[model samples]
Target: MGSDCFDESFHGYGEFWCLGDTRPYMRALGAIANLAHRLGDVDKSIAASTEALRLCHGDNMGQRFVLSSLLLKAGRFSDALSFCQVWLDPQYDGLNRPRGGCEFNPPNPELLTARLVEWHSKPWSPGNLLLNAAYAAFGLWGDCELARQYLVLGTRANPNIFVKVLARREKPDGPYSRPRTTNGTDEAHDYRWLTQDLWAEPEAWVWINTNRDVIDIVVKTCAREGCGRREMRPLDFKKCGGCRQAFYCGPECQREDWQAHRQACRQANAPPAPPDSPVYAMSGFLNDEGALDAMTLDNSDDSSDLSDLWEYGVEVEPY
Candidate 1:
């Protein structure tokens, strides 16, 4: 079926699909990706997944989940890490939301929700992405430090899912199966992954809400040597004028930090390099897909937590 699905040579291309109807083509590529993964062809899986992502309505459900998992399974940890981080990026909508020229039903409505359609859409999926990041960190880079950091964030995002993750962390058992969340009040409302059975320990799910710290601790640290104050530092951040990467408590700290920051800063301030990859870019282009044009470019919805308070269903304190 995978081969049949991808056999464009004998495909029946009617005008019905020229406009174009991306549903079948996207599914075919996705199928091919899975087939390649099962065959242990990592590069082929990524290539198929990447091309599938290029289809007009290709941001359908399970796309990123498949791509990320396949990248991990292939032992392409760096690629997997980069892919997961970017997809997890709230600003980039490829995996964050449904976008593309055409509309197709997501593979699992329960796992992946479509926001614009509301009742008709189910954009939220159960996969815990931060866990994948942790894996990409530890498995790929052997960076347990980074893995623990991501784990902290992952656990905070879905503590319910973390219950199982932490349990497995303690056990380190083989054949890691799909772990479900028990936090929700109703058992029927539980969330699970689409590719649970395939990998010994792939990724898991996050449901309902977020519990990540309102502000990241690292992002708030003062740049100056003497004053590395942690929190209550300031709601308002003062960014360096040079690299614009470093933040400080105020102008005084920014000036003070400059001497020490200058040497390392020169390298980053150097001439721009070529685009990293077809799937990654710093600005202007959105890698190759440009899927952000759909659903996200409008900017009607912001990723900030304060934005969550605006939701009608969100439980918030009354003024």
Candidate 2:
């Protein structure tokens, strides 16, 4: 009945029919272990592969290799190393080949080539594997020179692989290098043409400093004030009363208590000014004397008491 069942199970599959009853269970368990390992459940993978190895009696080299790989993934370095040593032993060379009378070339060279290429492309590949093994051996077995050798190899493969390797190296402690100021001044260079002198234009200046804190403050203040593309005006200077350190559009705006600028103005203007001296002269006021003299003539001979004077001449009333 068991044979019949096995035959029924193996009916459609060529490999199943060939390898017979035991091979199916061994292959199935091995596949499951590989799947578990890929899923990152290393413990389950180790268990499944161990069961497969027990059932196969160490005959399946492929299964053994997979188990060894799983052991490495699970961080069982000693066991994995032992397994790899045994598998790669000269005595096991013939055993690594496919079973007798198998039509397929036993150890497919194409698969090996593809695997090697894939492993070589990995960030931590053959080099990392060797270094890790060497380091592990040295650290656990009190071999300092071996550890140093592995450390060197690891650094050559990937400098960042070991943190200690970089511990002694110095890194830039300040901002990155940038173009130097053209004038060779410590002040930062300004690129805005508006800040430069141009013909048929009034000269203006801009102070550019590399001090990031000051730049940040200016940018933030401009944003908070809703200042837009409109050029900052001189009248804006009136709004900054406290220290004359800020600006606005005009006096009306400065007086607009809604922005609480009046308080600032009061604070600024509150400081006492020196009294004007007699030596300080004031400018002349506007004069209307010429117009007053032109209207001073008298005319009283007309029949109409004030008709001619009212019409064409200046009337001087006797009062």
Best by lDDT: 1
For residues 1-319, what per-residue lDDT tens digits would candidate 1 score against the true structure? 3344333343532111223445566557767876776676878977877666544233542356556656566666676666655555445554333222112222111221244123211223223555566656666544345555554554444333433222222222221122212121111112123223222343322311121331342125776788977534223444454444465677667556666777665655455454453222312212123232111111111122131121211122212
Instruction: Give per-residue lDDT, candidate 2, residue 199.
Output: 10
Off by over 4 Å in 2: 1-19, 57-61, 96-319
Largest TM-score belongs to which candidate? Answer: 1
lDDT of 2 at 214: 21
Model 1 RMSD in angstroms: 17.4
lDDT of 2 by residue, 1-319 (tens): 2455333243322233124555556557756775675576888977876665443333432344345445555556565544533443345444432221111122111112444334333332223333343333332443344333433343333322221111221222321123211111100111111101211122101111222322222231221144442323211122233323234344343333224443443444354333342211111111111011111011111121121111211121112
Candidate 2 yields a Cα-based lDDT of 0.33
lDDT of 1 at 187: 10
Worst 10 contiguous positions by lDDT, candidate 2: 186-195
TM-score of 2: 0.28
What's the TM for model 1?
A: 0.38
What's the C-alpha lDDT at position 122 in model 2?
37
Clash pairs (backbone) in predicted model 2: 236-248
